[model samples]
Target: MVTVKAVVAGSFGGPEVLALVDAPDPVAGAGEVVVTVEASGVGYVDIMARRGEYGPLSVPGFTPGVEIAGVVTEVGEGVDGGWLGRRVFSQVQGGGYAQKVLVGADSLATVPEGVGAGEAVAIGVNGLVARIGLERAGVGRGDSVVVRGARGGIGLMAVQQAAALGAEVTAVVSRGRPDDRLEEFGASRVVPSAEAGASAEYDVVLDTVGGAEVGAWVSRLRPNGRFVLCGAAGGAPDTAFGEALLENYHKSPTFIAFSLGSLPGPAIVPQAQVLFEAAAAGRLRGVVQEVLPLAQAHQAHRLVEGGGLFGKVVLTP
Candidate 1:
């Protein structure tokens, strides 16, 4: 009957519906480890989950959070005893908003020395998403890539990763701070949402902001290019499928959708390990705009929904 503090949703609604509640402490089941969370990332999907927009996978009154970084406090049966007391990060299935969380052993990535918990949490979701999207898009040295929503957590990571990979990045940002931060993230060019229509074509387009903008940019891909759709921050619009088809008929540019949830548990840890190494080598960096205690989970959600933060928001307990 051990208990822990967690943010819970009694109903599917807005950020206000999140409440601090006492819940039974999580324990490591077989092949799992119980962690004392030092930080949990607050992502766009968390907001969508709170509103019940994710459909079948959604649950009511569940603790919401997808990524956490902390120290392993206990190991379940059949797990390696060496994992005990190690600091790690996980791409959790859910329940990361609590002070303690259970994580599958297969999904754990050791946090490197000198990497803070907040940055590890950021790398857990947003970092992995960027890595997968860029790899899928086949971006390489001297390739030109376009990134929509370039100021967001994932988008900024994409910009930095693309640059580190030797690709020229064109960042499409909203009218204000987003534009400025995109440049800071190493985008070679920055364009406002309105002007993206006339920008130079790219070898690949990493679109985090889907909507009419997606349809517009799909037409901007060069011959044999790729377009990776990773988020819907710009709003999901009815895509002009016919137009998209017509625009790429000759080049045969590919369109791929990406979600970290689609990956197998075992695959994520290795991918996260690569990102951690990149961050440790200074080839990748995570921006964490704010870190608040678990009691401020509601406020953190509000800030995320309102937008304009230059980095990831994290909750700690």
Candidate 2:
């Protein structure tokens, strides 16, 4: 077995539970490829899995990264050798935090021209979610939109995509001095969360923040407005549906909870191709705020868990 290094989590706890350990290298099975991982992504979901909040999604003694980008180092029996040196990015069923990973051949996609592994992964799943979420929300020209957590990995790209779609966009941030960069990302205005209370005059609200605060944002939606609740960075909100919510806003505002988990699995990678095109053309982007060594996963986890990071935090394995 080829020996390689990976971040393995032995138990559910804080960042301290992550350990960089030597492990047997992966081998590609039929229709699979072994990638020498150049970058792995850390997101709120990775943090949730580490804390045991995902319940049964992960077990002790598992590696913990949800996305990866790399060069194909090996391919399985039926796979073509031409794939051997292709740079690729893919979302995996866990095990992304390693020097090498085995992925289904069909799941692999070439990195767009001129995009590095770190930047590719920074915009990988997170940007794809934003792209898809906006499409699912029917975001269109002349729509007024509000995106909570606007300076985040998902928010950064969401703001860009929404603006490109011709929506008037307002980005909501939680802290620090007002970021002039939000405008650069196509945000028409930046609203700090403290000031966001009850100010919702939006036609569509793409809320990544969940929890007790959701209603305040929802309250501002104009009649028949749509609010897409896709994240729980503050914590998952209390869920309600049907009549009670529809009656509150007079014109039947729509509340949709956007969860990739609830959808069929096969739909993810193919939809991500649109993101590749968007990024390739410079219409979509995400920031890679930091690239830490694989051994420093615990520190990376700590940073992602603490929140308010301005961009994606990637680990080079």
Candidate 3:
């Protein structure tokens, strides 16, 4: 009998709820493929889902991971046999915290030659979010952009992508000195979170951390500026930022809440391909802060929740 090992969340609460367990192996169904997972990423979103904060993933008994990279080992009916040995990565609804995972065949992205499985998951998923958010906000050369939570994975990518596009990027860290690498990553200036909304007006603000500060940042938007919310690791805004948003309505300020899930599967394939090639060419950088065994998923969750990591924490099954 075939069995699969996975980290299961028997109940939603803290990291303690996650346990490594064995289950009957899953088989690929029509339009699905089974991937032998190499590395999975742990992020603030996983922490939120584990704590029942994320509505769609609040259910118990589910494995909590979305960023996955692996080799395709099995294909379902109608799937191309060429996928049997391809290295791939994807973002799924759940079940990535396992030795193998079943995913839709259409969702797979080929991993480039030079990118490791860990780097694929780290850069692929976060970079996709950053790229899409920046594009949606119409950021371009010479735009003044502020990226909140710029030291973490997605924020770090946002900083790099915006700068690469010629935007004058300001990276806002939660506290303390910003990493020197953030500047190297293309941040023109590094500011503490408290200071990001102080004086400077920006053409675009990409917010990953949400709080009362969102209101302040909205007030700092220049005419025709865009404020894009990609994630809210700091918790949702409790302030009445709408009034501030309305104050700039005549100036044509744009507020956009972006989520990668809103996109179709086909939309990600080309983007992933570009990202993989960029990483391969050293144009894109991914930081894998730590790699832990699958059984230590609880520890991985704790580390992500505790914050201050410059990159991503990966779990190898």
Q: How much does candidate 1 score in TM-score?
A: 0.95
lDDT of 3 by residue, 225-256 (tens): 99999988888976688888987788789999
List the lowest-lDDT window of 10 residues for candidate 3.
Answer: 191-200
Tens-digit lDDT string for candidate 2 (1-317): 66999988899999999999999978889999999999999988888888888653568888888789999999998998999999988888678999999998888878878788888888988887787789888999999999999878888878998999999999999787668888998999997888765645888989887777776667777878888887778887755434346557576788887766554434676777777777788877769988999999999988877778888999997
lDDT by residue (1-317, candidate 1, tens digit) is 87999999879998889999999988789999999999999998888889898653388889999899999999999999999989999987778999999889988999888788999987779988988999998889999998887878998889998998999998877666335557777898888777766657889989887877677677888999899999876567455944885867898889898988888778888889888888888777888999999989899999988876778999999
Task: Tell me the lDDT of model 3 at 21.
Answer: 98
Q: Which residue pairs collide, candidate 3? A: none
All candidates: TM-score: 0.95, 0.94, 0.97
Q: Which candidate should be chosen as best, given TM-score against the real structure?
A: 3
By lDDT rank, best first, the candidates go 3, 1, 2
C-alpha RMSD in Å of predicted model 1 compared with the true structure = 1.5
